[model samples]
Target: MSSRYSFGGDEHVFVEVSEEMSLEAFFKALSMTNAVRDAEISGVTEICPANASFQIKFDPDVIRPDDLLTELRRLEDIADRAEATLDTRIVEIPVYYRDPWTHETLMRFRERHQDPESTDIEFAARINGYSSVDDFIAAHSGAPWFVSMVGFVSGLPFLYQMVDRARQIQVPKYLRPRTDTPRLTVGYGGCFSCIYSVRGAGGYQMFGITPMPIYDPDQETSYLREFMVFFRPGDIVKWRQIDRDEYDGCTADVQAGRYTPRIRDVVFSLEDFNRDIDGTNARLEETLYAD
Candidate 1:
C-alpha cells in the first residue's frame, strides 16, 4: 500500500498509511510507532498512532524535519519485514444495552436522529438488516473489538471488530449533534465503535452505557490507579451485555473502589486472525476469561 507523508507543521510529521481503516493499516502504524519509540530517536517528542495513520512530534531544532522523515521511512521498511504480531491485553467491558438513562437521552434527542420516530438502536437495526434491536445487540456483543485509536476525547477508544469487513457493524451518526452524552455510553458511527469517555457533546448513535469510567482523573480504582485511561490503541475490548441488577452492582463496586475490569495478557497475531477469524476470536475470548 502507498503511504502519504505530510507535515502538520515544522515539528510534526503525519503519515497516512491507508485511505480506509483496516486492522492491517492499524497494525502497521502501531508497529512502526513502537519501533520508533524503541529506537529512542533523538528529538522525537511523541508518537501517536491513529485508525489508519500515525504522527510523530519532534524538536525540529535538534532533528531536521527532512532527516526525521527519512528515518521514519527506514523504520517503516523494517516494520514491513517484522512479524505481524502484537503483545497486548484483552479487557472485558460490561455494557447495559437499552439502559434507562441512555433510553431517556435518546428519546429526548429523537429529533436529531435520522428517523425522528424511532430510537437510535431501532433505526440502526433497520438500516443494517437486523430484524430487531435485540438481534443487533447480540451481533454487536458477540465479537471482540480492537482499540484502533484513542482520540476525539481522551480515553475514548475507536474500536474496530476483529471480524471480517462484511461482518463488521456500521451505523450512521445523528442527523444533528446531541448537546450531551452520558459518560461511558457506548456509541457507534461510521465503521467505528466508541465509549464516551466523558459526559459532553457527541453525535455518535448511542446504544448503551457502561458503568465503569474509562477516563477517571482521580484514579480511584485499582485499574485506573496507575493510568487514568484504561485503553491503549492495540488493546482488545469485549463488550458483554448485563442485566440492570448486574449493572447496578457494578456501579456500586466502582463507587466503592472495588471493581477491577477483567483483563488478560495476550499475543495477537494478525496472520492467524486473518487466516481463521472465528477460531482466533474464540481462542481470544477463552483466554481473556480463563480462570
Candidate 2:
C-alpha cells in the first residue's frame, strides 16, 4: 500500500498507490506533491472481482521523476493517519455492435465449415455476445467504463476491462482483416483492450462501435491525452444488455439531444410539471399596483 513510484519512461512516471487509497487521499497526494503536475487516472486489468488497481499516468513536467518517488514515499509514511474521505464514481458508457450476423446462425455456418462445437470462432460468437453486444451496451446509455488512453489514431481511447457475464475471449481477425473496423474490441488475446476512434487494417476481431465522431479537432478538449478518466482502479461495472426496442429509443433520444439533459432543465421540468399538484409555487406571477 506504500506509494511506489517508478519511472516508466522519460516522459511518463507510473505511481502505483495502495489499493485502498481513498479517492480524496489519492488526489490529495497528487495535488500536494510538487512532482506531479497533472494526472490522468484510469482503471487497469481486473485481476479478480475483489482486487483491481488503477494505472495512473503522471505529468512529468511538474514533478521530476525522482521527486515524484520521494513525495509518494512521504505520502505512504502518513498512510495510516490519512483519513479516507474520497467517494469514487462509476461512469457508464453505451456502445453498439452490428453485422449481418447472429450467434446461432454464425455457429451453424461455422459448424458446417469446421468442427462447430469445437471451433473457437463459434465459441467466441456465443460467449462474447457478438450479435448484439454493441446494441446491448447502447441501451444502458451510461454503462460505467473508464477511458484509459488516447493516441491510437488521433482520438482513439483505450478502455479498461469490461464487466459482463460474457467471458473475455480472444477472437482472431478475419483471414484478411478489414480496413473498416473502427475499433478493435479484443478481450481475450490482449486482455480486452478496446481501441477508440480510428479505422485501418486490423488483425483483431471487432465486437462493437459508437459510430459518432470520436475525436473532434475543433473542440477545446480535442485529443485529450491527460484528464481524469471516468473510472478509477477498483470500480465495479455492470453491463446491462439492451434489446432492439431499447436501442431504437436511445437513437431517438440522441437525435433530439434528450440524452444530454441539463441540471437546469431537470429543475425547471420538475417544478413546472408538478407545480399545480404540489402548489409549491404559483404557475406565473403578475403584479398590479393599487396606488
Candidate 3:
C-alpha cells in the first residue's frame, strides 16, 4: 500500500499508511516509524506511530519539509523490505471486571449511553452475541492485545485486540463524552480497549478498573521508576480477571511500591502469528508464567 504524506501545518508531517485499520497496516506503519527513528533524521523532533499511520514532528527551519518527505520515502522503502517482527515485552494486567468504580461512573452517564437501561458491559454483551457477561469477559481476557498507539491521554494505551478480525470485540463510544472517567478505568471503544491512565472526560465504554498504575507521574512505582509511562506502542498486554479481594491486595501492593506486573520479553513474528495465532499466544503466556 502506498503511504500518503501530508503536512500538519508547518511542524508535523502525517503519513497515513492505510485508509483502514488492520495488522498489516499497523505493522507497516510501525516498521516505517522504527526505520525513521533509527535514521535519526536531522531536525526531526518526535515520531509518533499509530495503528495505521504515523506522524513526524520536526523543525522545518533545519530540515525543509520537501527534504524530510524525501527522506521518509526512502526510509519507507527500507521498512517495507525489513522483516516484520517486534522484540517487545508482554505485560499482564490484572483487572477486576464489573468493579464498583467504573460501574458507578457509567451509571452516572447512563443517559449518554446507547442503552440507559443496561450497563455498559450488558449492552456490549448483548450486541456482541455473548450468552452472558461471564462469557463476554472470557472473550475479552482470552486474547492478548497490542499497544498500537500510546496517547489519547498521557501514558494511556490504545490497544488493538490480537485476534482475527472476525473475532474482534467491537463497541461504540458514548453518545456524548462523559465529564468524568475514573483513573485506571478499563474502557473499550470501537475495536480498541484502553486503560484510562488518569481521571478525566472520556467517551469509551467503561468495563472495570485495574489496580496497577499504568501511568505514574512521580515514577514512584517499581516498574515505572525507569519510565513514567509503563506502556509503549509495541508492547503486548495480557488481561487477567481478578475478584474484588485480589484487586484490594493489588491496591495495597501499589501503595507500598511493591507491585510489579508480570512481564516477559518476546520476539513476535507476523508470519508465525498469522500461521498459528493461538499456539503462539499460548507459548508466550507459558513463558511469562514459567519465569
Indicate which candidate wins on TM-score: 3
- State the lDDT at 17 in candidate 2: 51
Lowest lDDT 10-mer window, candidate 1? 214-223
Model 1: what TM-score?
0.98
lDDT values of the candidates? 0.92, 0.36, 0.93
lDDT by residue for model 3 over 1-291, one digit each (tens)? 889999999999999999988888999999999999999999999999998999999998999999999999999888888899999999999999999989989999999999999999999999999989999999999889999999977999999988999899999999999999999999999999999999999999999899999888898898889989998999999999999999999999999988878898999999999999999989888877885
Candidate 2 backbone clash number? 11
Cα RMSD, model 3: 0.8
Candidate 1 clashes: the total is: 0
Q: Which stretches of candidate 2 lie over 4 Å from their true place?
A: 1-5, 8-11, 16-65, 76-86, 95-122, 125-180, 183-189, 193-195, 200-204, 210-238, 243-249, 261-291
TM-score of each: 0.98, 0.44, 0.98
Per-residue CA lDDT of model 2 for 69-100, tens digit only, reads 56545644664354432223332334344322
Superior candidate under TM-score, 1 versus 3? 3
